[model samples]
Target chain A: MKTTQHKIPTARPSGQRPSGAVVKPVGARPVIGGASSDRVIEFRGVTKLYDGGDIGLDHATFGVEQGEFVFLVGHTGSGKSTIMRLLIKEVQASSGVVNVAGHDLAEIKRKKVPYYRRNIGVVWQDFKLLPNRTVYNNVAYALLVTGHSRKQIREKVPDILRLTGLSTKLHNYPDQLSGGEQQRVSIARAFVNHPPLLLCDEPTGNLDPETSIGIMQLLYRINKTGTTVVVATHDHAMVDKMRRRVIELSAGRIIRDEAAGLYSRDESTREFAVRMRGARLGQPEDS
Target chain B: MRFTFFFREALRSLKRNAMPSFAAMVTVLVTILVLGVFIPIVQATTGAADEIRGKLLIDVYLRTDAKPADVARVRTLLADKTPNVKSVQFVSKEAAYAREKARFPDQYELLGKTNPLPDTFRVTPINPDKISEIRNSLLPVAGGGTVAVDPAIEEVKNRRDQTAKILEATNFIKITMALLASLLALASVLLIANTIRLSLFARRREIEVMKLVGATDSFIRWPFIIEAIIVGGLGALMAISLLAVGKVAILDPFAETFALIAAPETLNFGLLIAILLAAAIGVSAAGSTLSLRRFLRV
Candidate 1:
């Protein structure tokens, strides 16, 4: 799916906190990543310990440069979600530094968290669309929140919906749409603002093989537009087929990171796994 | 954020979470209904009390053999010189006898036409609060003082103890009612807060999605606030409707039952509705704001 380009809202100046944020004088401290426009996300030895003595993440260190489509692959309880949470600043790092879009998240005031989140888009495994809102409203919600003009919302929403292959289902509620279509709505909502970064936590986790591939293709196309897309999923087959930059997590720690990574050594085994999954999805084995 | 968008979202959420919205509305209805009815009843009771107090008067009876000139002078003195006296009316012995006869016809018949009633002046006080002071000023000086004693005046009956007791009772009622109304208002605020908290709890996921979508805390909160206000407003409307119905069906029909007391018109329907609506919206907004503060941290 393709559509005419639309304007994305520009990011706020780094280190300039929004109202209600703990106000610090501008340039109170040197900007964290001065002169580094290409690096979008940087984490240096970030550690996160939950309230009950459980380690959510342990001294994780990584950087995702601009316009890169990276996959974070891990098993359940491997801290994949924690990384996403940290990137979105849902939880703060217990120790060390975490920076997104050149603003140090630790330094970002609590009130400014929403402003920080607007710079990126996020998707979830559950396809968190408002049950009552139509596909159109769901997509427009992204623009509506960032306080876009009604004219901008009217113009931007349809283009993004078309891009996500949901233009035909504009008036359809989430329940009326198929799982794949609902996920498309989620994608449309996530990318409606054309955010600099897109974070998907198991975007295809709830989908069947054919539908999952369609979603991946859509995400791949979105990534081609120079928007950095980071997807955290355990879908080995899709990861293998894509052969993209993959960061692997094990027990709250990154174990393996590759420029172009596969989940396992054997591509045929992954293909068989995908076929079995398709079979369970009621797709013919041959397909 | 667009106002229309917030309004739409609030409406959608209210529909989506029908049970909580209904519960909140019901809470508002009960709370506002209590305040609405309680206020007017208090006003009506105070009016009735004041009417009863207004009728209280002091009677100065003359001696049986008193000269007419002395009676006339005393009446003039009460009317013109008494500090808090509102008005004075002289009732001759014949008029007094006629009034007594009208009041107790059988007793007058047993008296065999003898006019035993005394001539008196009824003194009405301008300020009920200064009744004691007026009574003290009117008492005849008995010994060793230059204060002139009108010997022809037999008794000064001001009903001081009775008036004090009545005023005390009315004040007690007023204070008790005010205290009760304040307690109910406090309870209403707490109930509203609890209901809004529950509604917000059910919509916590929606709030999470909103936050993820880059909504500022205010953007995420405004819909819930507006929804709460609407629920409160509906509750107020319902309460006002109920009050209007009650006024027509209960209060107006029974007006004769309270004919002895002046009707207090303080609870005008239009003014009461305006006040109730403002209170409903204000309280709901306050409750929602308090509850949303904890949840909108995302």
Candidate 2:
């Protein structure tokens, strides 16, 4: 196997970790019709009405600027997945505009939607790796879709694999790997394109808290490279500890948009605070 | 490079989804096999029926006083105007009398100088099923005995008792073969189409992964199309090979031993195989591409 000379991304200290800086009010109306929208993702009065008149998202609006790490924290059926689906163009907005990476989702033709999606990478809780493909091929598949040269894939795949800490398991198929390793491969595939935006739908939902942190750290490192990351997860403790922007949804509505948000204000208990304190002490969070 | 990648991916999936792939292959094989074996049989049987049909001769007797102009008009109507009449042979009363005299001199001599055989027009139709059509056109529209509506034709005579049985039998054979061949083909196509659909459902997650990873729709679709082609092609080839062996080893011997009345032209084996291959592959590819629409709705 060929080795990548590209340096592997290292772990970040707690203090230096990236977080969302700008705080916006809940349900803020997105400014429309700018020549160059710095917002990597913008949802303006977005609503997703599914078949039989069921609403997936109800006039929800939010924006994430370039290079922001935001967590989408919501319960099951709270319409968090709908936002990710809209951003990725998996589902269309029923009555609003969705702009991702400055391309309006509604404007993309069906034939050109694939090219439009190339700018955004998506991950799901299931890790969604090709079951029969090796980790290397799974990651390389992203670049392959864009018609990259063999040399480019050979170089880029290993670098992303190394960054995701899967260099040793390049040839391992998804089912052969642990849940965390599979999730890492999934992330590697999603990040290999170095897309401007990455959307994760409960990416670490199946992994233990420890493995979930490892996956999150890998995402963090990618986010540090200036890729805007949107993680839709219900991992409240992990979101609380990271202190990134949390966009919480309830009943198809934006209930909270907090800068340096906890998973929930109610989750900011004394026990959780002690855990954070211990996490800050010599017992490292990176491990 | 893209082609090679798609082919490799197809091959890998073929191995991974061995059961569904096998079922698809088997379905194609059975469809082609049924078609291959039955088509030539139908063709051969129909050819024989056509041969028997070619011999149906309709004899139309003309009035003894028919004018030359009337005879010419009747010939023109039967020869140029009719749809099914292949050829019209004119035999005058003297010519008909001479033919009968050559066969039996005493009976004709008993007739003495009087010749009872009228000037006849012998009509050969294109097909046996067409005999009734040709006969119908010659009959009087007023509907009586089998006399022509034309003034020249005294009576239109066919050996209805003997010819009716042959025409009915041949017609039944042709109709049954045609119906059976079409039904088999339709059944085969539906079977493979369903098989491809089921396989797609099984591998839907694979499609989901490919789409989310920024793969274009065409990029995601190529491997599946290639896979279907392989399955369809392999199945058709297998069935064809079996048919070829059966033709050489079994059918050839039986065809020779029977000493059939006429050597009939059946469907060309090469053309049949080509058609089967094309149909199998086309259906497989079409099925996969169409079924893919539901899952690709991103």
Candidate 3:
């Protein structure tokens, strides 16, 4: 386990500490062995079957720790996208427990879904930017949803735009921007509210290799700033470059789990290669 | 902030779809104008009928045996005692006989043997509405000298009451027309709202994306609702103006034909206020209800 150097402070006052108090420094990672206690997402025996009885995910069990950048790599029909959907409560799990940001996916009220989404950011391959709205408004939308005042929005929007390298295109509409620029605007929009979790569903899928690499670098930078990042893709090259923790799925099952894996290998090593390549490069070699 | 955004968006959308908005406005205007013209005429006729009812009068006849001094005393008593009596004229037996002979010339030859008519006091009430009460009050004063009211005057009052009733029925028809007009206006609003909804549905993907990014449902609906309101308001305004012009151009000339009976000046500020209020309420209610139900889906 790679330990974060920061020390965690006591959760309660020392004078009022009960007999069971576990003393720790301020900012220390809340980890037991290699697993962190502050998991942002959890899936316990989760299953999702489509309307026609086709299985989307079959008894998936996993956990994503807070502020941890995790890659979810799988082939087509392997349930990577299903996991992402379930995490955001876009689709309910068929059975078992699925929790994200302290809300149970199965029991969360429909009206509260928007509030739930406020704690998470979603970036898409298509950018999903309104062609009529400028880049600034697109990013400002996230903050607006969280009921941020106009003054706060005005102050925060410019800073996020600058951070996402979209300051120059603040006045530009989606139609006027290139694919890469649109993705940047999307990223800015996703992160403007400073959500604790950021889910990118093939964020670099539509871009060329250079653009894909740039977007991957941007995601890498975002992940380092303590925002939990989950990228669902079959992208191999970008994944290998980042060399992050990888969870590979096959036939709706987590077939391989590797730490610091590479992009390519022989038939037996295909799992690690695919997972690593997808994580770092954001595109599988075959895809 | 939401309303501001909605207003801006609605205004922008209206500008963008100028032709359709103009069409909607015109539809609203025409409907409201029709109502404006139809309502006032009905109201004026009702007013005139009421005026006639309040100004009706009756006459009373005295017995032939009654002396001239008795007739004079009766007249003075009626003038002083009756609250409603404006004045009383003593028609002499000779004058009554002359009037009867003039009314029926063939009967005058039979009456030549003896004057069969009695003297009478033609009593006019200050207010026609008080005629019934005045007649009821004067009945007990008929002593040995018989007091008789004119049958012709009673017939005229009955005719006026019937006319007033008919005029009031016309008011009912006018109200029915207003109701029908309002219903039609509501239908128009629904149609316009459906049109806006269709436009919004065309951009469903954009809306979904907006939702995914945390835009509230109200934020999504504001622009469409605002657009409907603007369209409805403009339509109502146009209808009012057209109605005013039509009243001036068409109603004024039509009223001149019945200048003796219909007081054109009766369509005053109160009436105008009533018409404007009805239109404003009708348009606003239709627009808001349709937009909220059809477009907002709330």
Q: TM-score of every model?
A: 0.72, 0.85, 0.63
True lDDT of residue B96, candidate 1: 86
Q: How would the docking of model 2 be graded?
A: medium
Measured against the true two-chain complex, the DockQ scores of the candidates, in the order shown, are: 0.53, 0.55, 0.34
In candidate 2, the second chain superimposes onto the true chain B with a TM-score of 0.81
- Best candidate (score: DockQ): 2
Best by TM-score: 2
Q: Which 10 successive residues of model 1 chain B have the least lDDT summed? A: B259-268
Query: What's every prediction's RMSD, in angstroms?
Result: 9.5, 7.9, 10.4
- True-contact fraction per candidate equals 0.80, 0.72, 0.57
Q: Model 2, range B125-182, lDDT digits (tens) per residue? A: 8766667788788884564555566877888878998898998898899999899988
Ranking of predictions according to lDDT: 2, 1, 3
Report the C-alpha lDDT of model 1 over B1-298, residue by residue, as the tens digit: 4688789878988887888899999999998998888777777777766777787888878887778888878877887877899998889999988888999999899998788878888888887777766666766455764233466777777777898898888778778877887888788888888888888888788778888777888888788889988999999899889988988898777777775322655457788789889999999998899888777776
Query: Candidates 2 and 3: which is better by lDDT?
Result: 2
In model 1, the clashing pairs are none
Candidate 1 at residue A9, lDDT?
A: 21
Q: Estimate, for each residue in A182-268, the C-alpha lDDT of model 3 and write its tens digit.
A: 998999889888889999998988998767766776776677688999998888667655566666777777665444333221322
Off by over 4 Å in 3: A1-36, A50-54, A75-78, A240-242, A249-287, B1-183, B222-224, B258-298
Total clashes in model 3, counting residue pairs 3 or more apart in sequence or in different chains: 28
**Cα deviation in Å at residue B155, candidate 1?**
11
